[model samples]
Each structure stands twice: as C-alpha cells, then as structure tokens.
Target: MPSNIPFRPFHRPAPDISATRKPDGSLIVRSNIPLGNYEANIGAYWRAAADRFPDRAFLVKCSPDDTWPELSYRTASEQSDRISSYLLSRGYGPDKSIMILSSNSFAHATLMMGAVQVGIPVTQLSPSYSLVGNDFTKLKYAVELTEPGMIFAEDGNTYAAAFESLDLSDKDVVTISGKDHGGIRFDDLLGPVDSVSVEAAFSAVTGESLAKILFTSGSTGMPKAVPNTHEMLCAAQKTLEHVSESLDAVNDPTRVLDWLPWHHTYGGNVNFFGIARVCGTLFMDDGKPTPGLFGRTIENLKRISPSRFSTVPAAYSYLADQMEEDEELGHAFFKNVKICQYGGAALSQEMFERMQQLAIKYIGMRIPFGTGWGATETTGTGTAVHWDSEKVGLIGVPTPGITVKILPVGEKLEIRIKGPNVHAGYYKRPDLTAQYFDEEGYYCIGDAVKWVDPDYPEKGMIFDGRVAEDFKLANGTWVSTGSLRLSLIDALDPLARDVVIAGHDRDEVGILVLLTEAMQKKYADQPGALSADGRRIVAPALIEAVQEKISRYNQGNPSPSRRVGRALILAEPLSVDKNEITDKQYINQGAVLSNRADLVALLFADDGSGGVIKLNKNNAMKGDKDVRNEQADTA
Candidate 1:
C-alpha cells in the first residue's frame, strides 16, 4: 500500500485577478497586482548598483583555459560608459544601431547594456543562423532587414565566412578577438567617457525607446523582427516582481549560473534583465542541457552554487539525474538555492517530483520550483506559478498591470494578453502586427490554457497545447496534445524522453517517443530493438513500456481521443538541421509532422515488422514484434 503524500507547501501569494464575461461569451481575466516602481530603463538599476556596490563582482566567465575572469560592478560601469560614449561619438543611436553576431560572453553583456542603456537599439542575431544553418539564408535575411550601422562578434575570425559576402561598406564591424578580419577592435569602442553627454543620453531615454530587436525562428516563414522597448523589458520585470514574493531575494544580488543565449527573449529579458535588476553576480555558463555539453554544467554546479536558479525543463531533467548520482553536487545545488525556475517548455511530472524529493532529502524542505509562460511579443515572462508547488505545467495568473482574455476556439480556450510588458509591434511589419491583436488590444498568443480549478481562478491555469498545433480526429473528437503528451511522459516515466503526438485526422492518437539514455543503455546489445547510433533506434522495450502505461491510462480515462493507440521509438532523433528542434530542446510539431510523414503512417498501418508497435484498446493490428515475448524475457 502507498502512503499518503502530503501537499507540498507552496506559499507565494497569488496575484489579484478579476474575470469578466465578455459580450461574446469570452472571458477577460486581469490582474490588479501593483508593479514595483522600476527605473526608466533596465540599465538605470545597473548604474545605481555599481555606485553602491562598486567592488562587487558583476559578470564572471570561466574559460576553457582554466581562467576565471571577472569584472566588478565599478569596472564594468566605467567600461560601459566609455563604450557608450564611443558609440555616441560614432553617431550610433535608435535608428543607427549596433548588431551583435556573437555568442554570450562578458563583452556581449557590457556592449548590449552600454548600447541599450544609452538608447542605442541593439539587434543580437542568433548564432544558429550563421553557425548551424547550411546556407546562412536566415542570416542574410536578418542583415538585409535590420541594415545595422555596426556589427560586433566575439571573434572576427570565427565569423569570417559568415560576414565575407555580406555588404558592410557603410557598416562598422568590430571584434574582441583582434584577428584582423577587416574590422575595428572592441577596444576601439572604449574611448574617453563624456559624462555630460552620457548622462544626458541615459536621462533622455523613455519607455518608448527601442532597446532591442530580436528575430523569430523563421521556421514557419520568413522571420519577423519583434521590437522590444525599454518599457516592455522593465515593466515585464516589475510585473514579475508583483506575482513573486522572491522579490525580497532581489535586494541581495542574485548569484546565477545560466547559459540561455542573449539572442533569445527569455535569456535577454527574464534571465539577463532579472540579474541586472539587482546587480546580481552572473556566472556565464558555457554549456547547454544537451548530451555533450551538460557535463560542463554539472562541473559548474559542483563548484559555484547559485542563490536562485533559472533554466529550461530539459536542463532540470539532466541536473536532477546528476544530483542523484553526485552527493556533493546535490548538497551544493540545494544549499543556497531559494527558487528553482524553468521555462521554454513544461517540466515533466516525474522531473518535478524528482527535484522535490531531492530537495527534501538535501535541504529538509522542498525548494520552490517555478515555471513562467510568455512569448517574444510579451518581452519575456508573463504568467508565473510564483508559488512553491510540485505540480508541473501550471502557468499561474497574470502579473500586475496585465490582463489575460480567454476565448473559446473550437475545443480549446485561446489565451490572449495585454499589458505594459507587451511589445509595441513587430518591427517594420505594421500589417502583421495589426492582424495579431484583437479590438480590445490583447495580443493573440495562439496558446490554449484551462484554469486548474473552475470555481477558484487564483489557483492557476494548465497549458493545453498550442491552438495551431491541435488537430481533430476522424470522429471529430479533439485531442489536447500538450496535456496528453505530459500524461504519456508521466506514465512511461524514464522511458519517454519527448513525444510527438500522431493521428491528427485519424481514428485514434499515437506517439513517436524519443527514448531516454537509460533505455538506450539497457538495450545496447539488442540489434533489432536498440542501435548504437545516437540518432534513431527501434526498441521493443520502448513499445512495451509505452503499451503498459497507455493500457493503465485508458482503463482510467476511457476516452478514445486521449488514448495512445500505437507508438514507434524512432531509430533517428529529431535534428536541428532539419529544423525539427529548437535551441531549448522543444520539438517543432509542424516540422516533425511535415518531415517524417512516412513514420507516422507506420504507426497506423496493419503490418509493421518495421518497428511500429500497435498498443491500443481500439483494434490496431498487432505487429510481429509484439511485446508478449519481449516483456516476459525482460521480466
């Protein structure tokens, strides 16, 4: 018999909200929580913090050469002032701005802060467009769209091939690496500090001032530039502060170890701006949550324990496993961590439970786990489950000065938001911007969220998949892909890494599961089931695990649309080159469905000696590789 699990105590106060029924039967929910009195721009706080805590470490970088280089607040401030003055002298401002084509570093932070602090809009292009893409098509498009005055990269030599054919006649190109790739040195940007002009420029900045222009992934179509203003970035943080009692932690500089790219909105506004808000000590992490680089992240966590933590769900999954294995890391991670946060995607229920159990074991109490929801147009975080809860995928109420309107679209509740934190519009695309907003001015975010409790709205909302991603079954029964995906992951536990929902217009739902490392290890010698290649593997054990779980789930729910009829453990993993996955490890549903339509057919087909396993209450014909023999052998 299982013991009763106590409610994990989560006590951050809920934001004030009011829900009104619209004339068209839609619901408009608004939060009355008051925002903090933030400065005119994000950099103002940085400037003040430097003055107050002059010698405190601002940005620390741990390089491959075993060099841990750091810049104090005072030094960073002075350098930024010099850089700002030089940019001003060279006539760089809102219209004539700078574009950074480098990965995140100490220089990237200062340059971005210096330019944006003094009203020079900065456009940081994603390194993927240059480094990862085969043709550099997106980079070419971005350059043509922005037509920036200056372009800066960490090393000119590294980006030589990317910038070679690009037209940079009127543009100033600068690099920190001094490799002499027909560009000015980063040191050249450090000139005499004209305090009078710099101060005036900072003071003159307003909410309307353009701080940055970030491009979308361009997976669906040509990328659209989202213009984020100072008000948008600053107001976003203020609203975030309202929902979170953790603002108390903001008074003391936050110690963070993060790797989210500066080009991404979550990295720039939520992670980066959140640190700068309190003059936090940021240890720039060089590794990601992916297979090869996560070791670097583990090494960092083994040493520098953060006061608070923010990372994607995939990273947390990897970290949670490491913590269980490494006792020293487990203790250090929970020692000073007040809040553990995740974004980009929903945290799996197993991962959420794993972290809480580890926290209880290590810290004697559960550390608060938070997941925020928003988009590029929202300037970063919007709804945050600021409370301490073990529950996954619950995106809480709107932050202060923001309203969320939920309209019924087909079978899902479409969530829309409007507030100070919201972006003004897409850059140079007034027509597209106009179409995205409703008459009431709420930006249609295309997400579907259902309230956790119908009677009590303060509890929070559960994200049902994206409206655009959802498709109706043959019998017209709508499947909530996001909700169902979470259920499958939970039921399958460690076996299901990430799943793509199949049977869009079919009789029943199916799944394409990306197997876990543990699963891969278990079947290392099995030739037919598991392969050595990291990309794709067909595993009978994978199908066996999923079938048992789905059967258990079907006995409870008894809904055809919610059932996982068949499953295929692919021999190949989703590739970034194929545009199947995002930087945050989120699978692009459309891209996957479009690229691998053949694999999807095998799930529904009668005969699949081809690795697809039929596992359903509804009659999906059993393949020769049925788990009856495989299951007994494993047992």
Candidate 2:
C-alpha cells in the first residue's frame, strides 16, 4: 500500500536584521543601507580591494604543470585600469557594451573588470554555446541584445570565428587575448594609464546604471535580455554573504578551485563575485566539469585543496565514480572542502549518499552538501540551503532582504521572489519584463515548491517541480515531471545520467532513461544485455531491479502521479547538438519529447512484442559491431 504522505507547510519569522552565523561559521547580515546602485559596475569593489589588500593574492590561474599563476589585488586593479583606458580611448565606455567570449581565466576576469572600471557593461556569453555544430541561436540573441561596441575573444582563432560568424564588424574594436591572431594584441591594451582618471571614472558609476545584459537560454524563443546593475550584483553578493554568515564559515581565507563557465550566473555572479566579495583566492581551471575535461579538475584538485567546492550534479556523479575506484584521489579532492555546493539540477539520492560516504571516509567530517534555487535573472542564489544545517532538497530560507511568496496556481504554488538582487527588467524586452514580474513586483520563479513542515515556520521548504513542466494524464492525474525525474534519478543515481518522464495524457507515467557509459559497459556482456539504441533491450534481471527501485519510490509517495508505470532505456545520450539539453546539462523536457516523438509514439503503439518492442521501420538497428562503430564515431 502507498503511504499517505501528509502535506506540510513551512513558515519563517521575518528576517532578523542582526548578523547571523552560517552553518559553516561565517558572519552574514543584511546591510542597513541599500547597496548603492552602480549599474553592475564591479570596478569599485576592485578598487576597494586593491586599496585595502594591495598585496593579497586575488586571482590564480591553473596550468597543467600544477604551477598556479597568482595576481595581487593591486596589480590586477592596475592592469584592469589600463585595459579600461584602452577601451575608453577606443570609444567604448558607459552605455557602450563589450561582448566577452571566453572560458574562466584570469584574462576573462581582467577584461570583465576593465569594462566595469570604465563604466562599460561587459556581457559574457557561454563558450559552450559557441561550439562547432551546436546551436548558435543563443549567441546570436546575445549579440543582438548587447549590440556590442567591441568583441573580446580569449583566443584569436576560436572565439574570433564566433565573433565573425555573428557579423559584428560594425564594432570599432576587436581584441584578441594572445598574440599570433591577426587582430589587435592584448598587450597593446596594457599601456600606462592615469590611475586617478580610472578611479574617477569608477566613482562616476552608480549601482542603478546598467551593468550587464544577460541573455536567458531561449529554449522557447529568442533569449530574453535581462539587465543587471551594480546594485543587483551587490545585492546578490550580499545575499550569498548572508547565507554564508548564517552557516558561519565563509570568511576564512581559503582557496576556491572553480571550473564552471563564466557565462552562467552561478559562475559569473555567485562563484566568481561571491569569492571576490569574501576576499578569497580564486583559482580558474581551464577545463570544464564535463566528462571530457573533468580530468583537468581532478588534476587541479590534487594540487590545491579548495575549502569550498561548487559543481553541478553531473560532475558530482562523475566524481563519485572516480572516488569508488581511487580512495586516495577522493581524499585529496575533498581534503580541505568545508562546503560542497550543488545546483543547476536536482541531485539524486544515490549521488547524495555517495558524497556523504566519501566525505566520511576521506575528510573524517560530514562535510555538508548544499543545493539552491535561482536563475540568471535572480543574479545567482535567491534561496539556498545552509550546507552545515539542512536536509537534502530544502532550498532554505530566503536570503536577507529578499521576500518570497508562494502564489497559488491551481493545485500547486509558484515560487516568487522580490528583492534588490532581482533584475530591474529585461533589456528592450518590456513585454517579457511585464510578464515575468507580478503586480506586487515579485519575480515569478516558475518553480513549484512545498513546505515539508509548513506549521514549523522555521524549517524551510522543499522544491516540488517546475509548474510549467508538469502535465496531466487523461484521467486528470497531474504528473510533476521535475519531481518524477528527481525521484527516478535519486533511485538510480551514480548509474543514470538523466531520465525523461513521459505518459502525460496517458493512463500512467513512463520514462526514457540514459545510463552513464560506465554502467552501460558494466552490463554490456551480460546475458540478454542491451545494445545501444534509442530503444535498448535490457536483461530481464536488470529491468526487474529498476522496476523494484521505482516501486520502492512509489511506496513512499502520496499518489500514482509519483509512480512510473514503465520505462524505456535509451542506448544513446542526448547531445547538445540536438537541443535536448542545456549548457548546464539540464535535460530540456519539451525539446527531448519533441525530438523523441517517434520513440514516444512507439511506447504507446500497439505491437506484437509484449507492449515493449515495435518493428524498426527506419532500420535504426543493425548488430553490436555496427552499434559499437557508431558509438566510436560519437566519442
């Protein structure tokens, strides 16, 4: 019998203005005065840091040899000033935007600071978006939104091609990072500059002035350009500071090894600015946290023991695999980590358990892992769990100075937030701006959330799912895809990469799952083993195991809406080229459903092979040899 799970409500007292200790032992409090609006100009902070901690190491760049390059606050500020002067001299300052296309590097930070110093807004676009054969639509939307005065490419060849492809020739200046690119050399922009003049320019900037125009992933249409000001940026930093303070452990002078792309808010606003605000040394890893580049992250981890670690769930899943194989590497990777933060997607319980086990075995302490809920428009973190003091899936209390309201939406509640960190509006997108915020000025988060202990008033709430992503069965049973996906992943974590929940307007929910390559290889040679296909044929034993897991999950849920009636294992992983996934690796359900319409149709199709097998009309199947060849080609 399914359990009768009771609905619980969560309430909280008004945020205390007094400073609080975060679970990690950092002090945080809401500022009495509003952070002065400077329209996203980060240069003032840079100047302040330079003045106060001139010799303190500000940024570090990691190289393959383990030799980390360090730059002091003073030197970085001076270099940024020179770059600002160069940009201003070339007719790019205040109101004139520059588009930065690069990964996370010291050069990227310097260019970003330089733009802010001269009062010019700099918008960083994801380097992943610029990949060959991947969708460049988002990049185009960004280009159109910013109408940049200059395009700064990390390298002369790769990023320069992206700039040219966007047809940004009208821009007055084009600068490349390294020499050898047939463009203006980066060194030329570092000539002597009047420090006084740069300071004056930065002073002229205000928090309300436009700082950056960030484009949302246009999964639906053209990406909306959300404008962020200095005030907004500072508010985000303050929010993070408050959360850290509540945890009480972020102020310690520690090193952070980050590989999240600078283009995303988690990287740009939270990880990067949050680190700077706390005056910590940030080591930029050139490699991403993806399977292809995660080796670099491990290599970096071996060299530096970061106090705080932030990564997406996918990366953690991969790391969990490595940890199982090499205890020594796992210990080194998590040696100094006090807080391990996960976001961007839901974390599976399997992955979560593995993390806890690794922390216990290696670090000897239960390093609290946290997750948060926010978006690019929110500047990074609006609601986050206190690492040292929360259960999994609880997106903790609202940050200081932020107001959250759960607005009723039929049977569910939509999460909404109102705060200084909330974006002023979308750039030249008044329609979207009006639609995104309610009359009360709360930004509609589009996520559904519920209180696990509503009457308790202090225990915070748990994330439900995306309201927009939920759909109803023909019998009127609404299935929360986000919730179902989370539950499924939680049940099969460390083995599955992601799963797509289907059966909307059907009798019951179904699933299309993609297992990690490691797991696929593990069962490759087993009897009745599945071959890689959109419809992989798995062994009855493994199928039963998965079914039992699903059954176990359903046993604790309230209704059949949370249950999976059947599942189809996909042999192939969804790729970015297909638009079935986002840069952050979140599966786009609508896109995936549309792309796999045929497979889905087959799931409901009448066939002679026990409601599972349908004749391959397209001749997609061959033999193991051909499938292996295709896999090799993909790799």
Candidate 3:
C-alpha cells in the first residue's frame, strides 16, 4: 500500500470547504459529497418508483414478430409480492438463499426482486455455464458457498443436465420456468396471498440485509461468491444515477436493448438497476455478443433502435464491421441512441475509431460513447467516463461515495476501492477475503492503471494492464500483455482473432496468433505458403504487413518494450476444451502457455538442434547460428 495517503472518512467534510443549505432546505456541502444513504433497502427504491410510475411500462421483451410484450410497474410489484409470499410460505425467508440459473428475462428480475423484498439472498449463475464440461464443479461451488434454500432454473432441460450429478434433493424447492417439466413451475409459485403478509415481509427487510451472492467467472480458478447487500445495491443505484445526471441524461422512460448475460454483474446490477431507477423499459435481446451470435443482435438492433445501448468491445467491433458493409442498417440501428457504454474488456483504439467514423457517417453525428471500469465485487461500476465526449480509454472520475486509491506497484498503480458499494467479502472464504483488501479497508481491484493526466490530477485514469498478466523479456524489460494484445489486434485488424504474448525470461517478446478464417484461407491458397519442413508457412507479404504495423506501434510508444521482436502465426485456434479460453471467449494466458509448451519452445529453436526448427546446414549464416543458439538457451 502507498504510504502516508490522506485519510478521509465517509461522512466527514474535507477541510477545504464548508457546508451549505439548498433553497429546498437540503444540506449541501461544498467539498464532501454526502455518502449515499437514500432508501433503506433496494426494494424500497423499486417500490417508490413503482408508486410514482404505477402505470408506466417497466420492462418489455421483444417477440418473434418484432413487437413488445410490456409489463407495468404496478403489475410487476403485485406479482413480486405474491412471489415473496409464496417463498415465505415455503419456509424460505431472511438468511436463506435462492440460486437463479438463467439468462436475462423479465421473470428473472421479478424473482430477484421478490427475494430481495423478503430478505432472501438470490445468487444468479450464467446459463452458459451449463455448457462447461466441469459444470458440476461450478454448481457444487455455488451450492456449497451460498447454501441456497431453493434453486430456480430457467429451462428444465438445461437445469436437469446441469445439476444431474449434484445432490439437490436437500434443496427445499426446485422451480423451472420458460418450459414445463416434472418439477414445480415458477408460475405456480405465485398464488392467492394476503396483501398484509406481503407488505409486512417487505417492511421487515432492512438496508443491511444481504440481497444477493454473485460468483466470479472462474476463468482463472474456483469461483468466489461475493455477497451484495441491499445497502450496497441502493448505493450503486445512486452512484449510477449521479453519473447519468453528470452526463446530462434525462431521467425518463428510455428504451434499452441489451443481450449481456444476466449472470454477470454488468448485466444484472448496472444495466438492470440503472435502467430501473429511471423507469426505463429494458428489452432483452436473446443473443450473445460474439461473432456467431452477432447477426441476431444486429437484427434486434435494427428492429428496436434502442435509445440507450451497452455492449462489450468485441460486439462493437462486429457491429462496426457490419456497418462498414451496409450503411443503411447502421443508420437505422443507431438512429435513436443517446449513449453507448462499452465494458467487460478493454476497448481497442482501432475499434473505437471505427465506431466513431461509422456513427458520424450514418447517424449524422458522433455518437456519445463511454467506458466503465469495475468488477462484480464493486457492484458493476466503480468508475465511468462521462458521455459528454467521445474519449476512447478514459475511465472517468470515481462515483459519488466511492474512493479510489491507486497503490503504486513498480511503475503502474494497482487500483483499490472503498465504498458502500463494495461487496461484503467473499462468502465463507475469509482467507481469500483477507487477501483482497488492504489495511485501510480498500478492496484491491487487481488491475494496474495509470493516470491519463498526471498534471491535471482530477481527469481520472486509464487501464495499464493486469499485474498478473504482465511479464518480463530476456533483458528484464516488462511487457504489458493486455496493452500489447490490444496493440497486436489493432495492428492486425480484420485478420486476427486474438494473440498470445510469449517470451517471459526470454531474449525478446514473441507472439502466437490466431487469424480469422478468411485471412487463413487467403494465405492457404497463396503460392509458396507451404514449406518443405511440413509447417504451414505464413506468406512473406502478410508477415511484412504485420511487421510494419508493429513498427508503427513501436514508433508511437515511449519505450521499445512494447515492440515484439518475433511472431509466429498459428494455423490452429485456441480451444475451450484445451482450457486456453473461457466460456466468454477470453484468452487464458497460463492455460495457453501450459497447453502450447512445445509451440513456445519451437519459437526459440536453435540451428538444427532440439529436433525443432531445422537449419540449412549447407548455407548456414555465421552470426545467425549464434543468435539462434542464444534464443534457444533463453527459451
């Protein structure tokens, strides 16, 4: 931790300013912003909003015919109350947990609200997690940590297959929705219940009561369950509302179309609750943001034309490609969009510029775009760029009531945050929880970052890279793998899917690249692409293009550390089965390195030795042999 950092308490005013009163008799402080203590609980906010907009559309699901099925706030509240009563009748109340295994849907949110209202913690798991070969491991982890009283499955087949090996007989109830099964239906959970009992249940819940337990993606290790309290949710909602107001967003009934997985915090806490605070109607798009499912997303966008949009950077890249091909569809898609928020992964400069160009070309103006930085432990959003401008990499100022302490780790600062929005530590994992925070009670974010404007001081920061992902070259020069990976993609735009950085403790940085099938086919047909050694050789021209791009990137950087000294274009792509990729399609560096140990060794082969890369003995260059030997020794 950084030494002698100024200490500031949550309700204390800074020494620089004084408190004042607004004309409406509300206390206004000049320096210290009030820590968000608005509603007593998360359900209170929803109830207040429902009371204010009882007849307004709260949520909508797009149908196959391109029409919407709307649910009113009053109706949703009433149904939520019924569900709460039903849950209480089933002997599930405060201190009990219910796990939701589903995607984004109106019913998901309703069930979550009911659980929150009755003070029952709801833990949501990704529907795609069922596809993982070790699905039982993840399911068991959730069950062990949360100890859920009931399990609600979105679809019967998926639920059955996911939990077939688990001993869920001890669970009080197993409910299924979206499809009928032999088990209890979710619709059956709602029956005639007295209003007085429902109101009493809601009133009994408090701000400090636990609301949800969200698990990590488990891309690196076993998933950690993070408990979110009602206070934390209410605080996050206020922070989002404040940031939205700062960006001049109108608190009206905005339209939103999002396909982000409900299991993730970005989809559950930020998008869902953020929209609800404004009485917005959320339209669930049943499509992933990957290339395979992007067509469905585009189809939905063309039909809905949502006023506000959110997506990952890869999704935006795909949309940009589609727009480049058809301008008409781009125009229709972004016609009503006010702000487009991108998160989940770093936004590539190339993709950002493409989005800007396409938005201006089609929408008559540069669309307001923003990026957010946070994790599930932070309740989705801790920092976000204001959407008044189209800044590419800036993760804006800290939200109200949140404090960011950048602890210097070598040259970069690892981000740490402290606020009410932070989770109540990992569930039943005190050792893990103890490792995540500093002595000052700040939750270490694990990401390294740098200030965009060090002189200005309040301009916020930009992501540097992940501390664990960065490695050293042979000369001990540190390489930012995340930044280098983005640079590689920018350099090989429209050709590469992803690149893995190699050469830790080696002479120089090397890369293993996965090219797009189109580019792979183009090179496969080119003459002289096949080598005598039986290895599929990359075209010299294509390699030269990549080299030139790297040279350009090196020219823009302050140090030669960002440059890759060598690269090998791989014929095969990383596979999930090999543990080289996550379910969300993110590269797993350690797994990739372990799985491709031989390929990495081959990149540093010596002259005619190690049975790896064969050298031309007859025409062996003098200095080249020594260089190859040195590289091999380093590898």
lDDT (tens digit, per residue) of candidate 1 on 1-635: 11244433435775568889989989888776667576678787778778878888888885555787988889888988999999998898888888999888878888998899899999998887777755788888888888899888888778877877588788888887746566589888888999998999999999999999998766687778999999998898787666655544346557899888888898877877777666678888877877668888888876788877888776776787778888999998987887888877788878878887888788777677788789889988678787656477898888777888988998899999888889767888899889888888889878999989878888889998899888889998888888988787777776666788988789988888776655655664465554333234555655556666667776776687787777777656577766788766777888987898877776677753355567646533366454444333333
Residue pairs with backbone overlap in model 3: 474-506
What lDDT score is found at residue 453 in candidate 2? 71
TM-score of each: 0.93, 0.85, 0.83
Q: Give the TM-score of candidate 1.
A: 0.93
Global lDDT scores for all candidate models: 0.78, 0.68, 0.68
Model 1 residue 257 lDDT? 92
Instruction: Quote the positional error of residue 426 for candidate 2 in Å.
Output: 0.6
Residue range 1-635, candidate 2, lDDT tens digits:
11132111112223333334446432232323333333246555667667867888888888887477799988888888888888777777766888877677667788888887667888887676575554476677677767887766767666655655667457644455443334566677798896777767777877786777776766776667778788888778766665563332235575788876777787787877776666678888766656567878877887777877887778887777888898777878777676777887766766766777777677555666677788888898777665344357667656666667675686776778778889867888788888988877878869888765755534566788788889999899888776678778887665677788888798767788777656766655564465434246455445545555665655666366876655656755576666677677767888888889977875655442221322122312213243334344333
Per-residue lDDT of 434-519 in model 3, one digit per residue for the tens? 99987778788688777666654355567877888788877878888876787787777766656788878987677776665446
- Which model, 1 or 2, shows the larger lDDT? 1
